[model samples]
Target: MSKTKESIFDYQLFKRLFEYIKPYKGVFMGLIVLVVLLAIFSSATPYITKDAIDDSITNKDTKNFLFYMVLMLGVLVLQTVFQLLFIYYAAWLGQNLVMDVRVKLFDHLLKFKMKYYDNSSVGVLITRAVTDMERIADIFGQGLFMIVRDLLTMAVVFAVMVYINVKLSLIVFAMLPILLYATRVFQKYMKKAFEEVRTEVSNLNSFVQERLTGMKILQLFTRETVEYEKFKTINERHKKGWLKTVWYNSIFFPIADLASSVTIGLVAWYGGLNVVFDGTNVSQGDLVAFIMFVPMLFRPLRQIADKFNTLQMGMVAATRVFKVLDTTSQIDDHGLIEADGFKGEIKFNNVYFNYVEDEDVLKGISFNVNVGETVAIVGATGAGKSTIINLLNRFYEIKGGTISIDGVDIKEVTLASLRTQIAVVLQDVFLFADTIMSNITLNHPEISEEQVYQAAKDIGIHDFIMSLPNGYHYNVKERGAMLSSGQRQLISFLRAYVTNPSILVLDEATSSVDSYSEQLIQNATDKITKGRTSIVIAHRLATVKKADNIIVMDAGEIVEQGTHNELLSKENGYYKNLYEVQFLQEEAV
Candidate 1:
């Protein structure tokens, strides 16, 4: 599933697309039968009228006319019935199929490594899953089957015309080649135009999403005017791409209509001459039928070109969608063992890793945390402090080394099992738009609401959560915007604690909050880290002072590892320098 350009009408793309139809194959076949019925009924209209005029009206037979009229009316009712059923089932199948694809796509995205999201645009991915998926629906909903029906009707109409009078049929088809050539040219340009349109659409969505998410930064810097102009430029390009398709459409349909009109006139003129002069060749009934047949034959051909817009856009959408579906960025699940645990003893042995190739972020890093021991990793940014936590949880693969839990290689265990035992509370806490209780339990059925309340009380945040507008049932509203930074951090701690994992990793949660909240977090940290194996990437000296061991890092390697007092005892050591600087800052404050 490499990302490759999919050609319009590529048989392979269609084959893959049709694979989705298996679940609804029975209904799909029923729709096809409906299409056949509709096309046959539509094509029989002119033939019925020809019989009514020639056998009933011309011969002055009132009973025959009445009978043919009844037959035509009956066929119309059947056509309507088939059409109603087709519309209902097609829509049903279209929406359900889209739902299945979207669900599978979302599941695929969830399995992808963090690196995939790091380099991919969120808005472009939305276009793929949401917008592009709708266009693909148009193919099954109407474009594909409807076009087939029209083509089938045209074939039947053309056959009847030739059977009625071959000379007049040739006159009608004289104008056919010119319209088909125009359609061929129209399709070529429309495909290119739509591809450009799709590109611009993705660009516009990406630009807007990025800007809206970063609107705070833009407003703080007063760059609204600059960004607004950029938005206009991108929007104008999107508009121009769509206008090109409109331009082609404007040129194409008129030519088709004109071709049909001219063909009708030619058929009428030739048929009229035979009717007025040659008594044997064409009748008045036949002349009327030829006029009716010309439009029927050309209408589908014209609409085929129009309906192609759906197919062309669908082709473009499918290409972009398949590219995302084909991305090889998901973290491979390598083994079969299911992990359940008692103790948390983590080991990272000679780990080498990088986000990009050939540039190591963690250089042969090695560390060990014993069972029930609390270790704090301390360093400045880019010293690979956070990278250690990332590797421990297998957020990213290590280039060289082994990370194991309880002496079992983490890769050998199922990811869901391995991850269930580890909980991480990052520096930037994220809360979903959900109730406080739901956020704490993460809707995990094992943890009851009673457990959530007890856990909140144990960690001493029960009063704080109860003080909110709805107690634990309060909706946080979009990443917890209604709560203060400290409030969000407290909620994250409660979330991690209720999981009751064998291992807990806190990525310096206390550094960004006010002093009161910091004190609360410190108390919660003391309570939760009592017996679990905890790794705290600490920013403040307070949490680090209590650690069983301190690992000091600098530029992707461990500079020192020892107790806080032992590190302070060393003269001119890395930890000594860090401790002295922090002490001076505290004294000055």
Candidate 2:
């Protein structure tokens, strides 16, 4: 499912594109009818001119001349009406089609595992969801619909010319092969150019998105000038990609224009000769009509070449979008366990896992937490503390292991039901840019405003929320930037509490907060963990002192487990040594 290597006229791509149009078949059929009528009406104009000149003007019949003028006006009026209908309806169909595509793409994105996001660039995904969809929309609004209309116009124009005078028609068509060959060359080169242009667009998107999101870090490190130079490199690459497309267009259109001009010139030269020669069978009216029809024929061919680029760009976009849609990176959700109203005993039976292939983060780890037990896991950096929490949530598939809750393997339950029973609060809390109430309740219609208020009250953070300017309606802004870290942590506590999950996880939630906030969070934690199964991950030795059991981990394996005082009593033990260091450091501060 990497980027697609596609051609200019990909029949298979177009066949897939047509599937999206199937839902609007009625409107598509109507658009087809309008195209045929437009071509017919356009072709009628030249024939009317022929009649007005040969039968009305030349024969001195003013009545017939006036009648043909009225007929031409009627033909123009019909063309205008159908043209308007086609333009408006084509846009409508394109909008609906893009809407469906964008929604489908976003839904597919939601099902992907964390591994997919870990490897993907945010900017490239944004371009696929937004810019690429627009390109696909143009396939309908400007490319395919106009291509059909233009081809029909050429067909009708050629048919009328042959009927009027086959010899003159043959004379004009003599230069078509040269023009067709030029167009073919144009399509081949432009397709490659357009692909490069899209690649550069994705590159630029990735560069800008990363730089902007990390602007604070860039400023703090005073790396602005260095980063600017880096952006210039990417910008140059993007510029060159587009310039290649412009260069292609600059060469292509002139060749097409010259071929069109040469065809018109040849038609004029030979058609004029036939009108003047003594033995010529072609009439002046027929010659004039054939001359007019030359542009009608070549102009559409030129337009088709132009619209073909549009079609090609859309096909490239479709290929990228469909690749994502066809991805098999989603976690299997067919597990049948309901995961409701059960004892919350969790066990990790010889689990082995890694975020990256062949690099084990957790190696043959096993642990058991009985129902309603509070077990604190204390570990050094990269000792697989957070990895344990991620595994419990099934954010990743373990390489080899069985994680069970209440004697049932976690993988035997549906993901939704499994996740509904566990709530996680991490040290790096994330809050959407929304009202305080929405951040607390996540806009879950089932969690009412009164329930949110009561949860905050139970956690003893209700007064703090009411102290804000908008109370529950206060906007946290992006990433809760407007609030202090402790305030954000308290909001996370309320969020987890309101969920009422049977199993609770607090992963270093107290690591970064101030002493005052730590006390408040500890109070909240005591209330919530009273009757539930809890697994707390902490780096600070003092925070887990009151746990029912403490597990000391180093190098991805548990070295000791006992009550806090029992572990502290062992001479030269890892937990005892670590606890003494942290306790002395806090005492010194």
| Candidate lDDT values, in order | 0.87, 0.87
For model 2 the local lDDT of residue 125 reads 97
lDDT for 6 (candidate 2)? 42
RMSD of each: 1.8, 1.9
Q: Which residues of candidate 2, in runs, are more than 4 Å off?
A: 1-6, 277-280
Query: Candidate 2, 531: how far from true, in Å?
Result: 1.3
- Candidate 1 versus truth, CA RMSD in Å, comes to 1.8
TM-score of each: 0.97, 0.96
Residue 262, model 2, lDDT: 82
Worst 10 residues of 1 by lDDT: 1-10
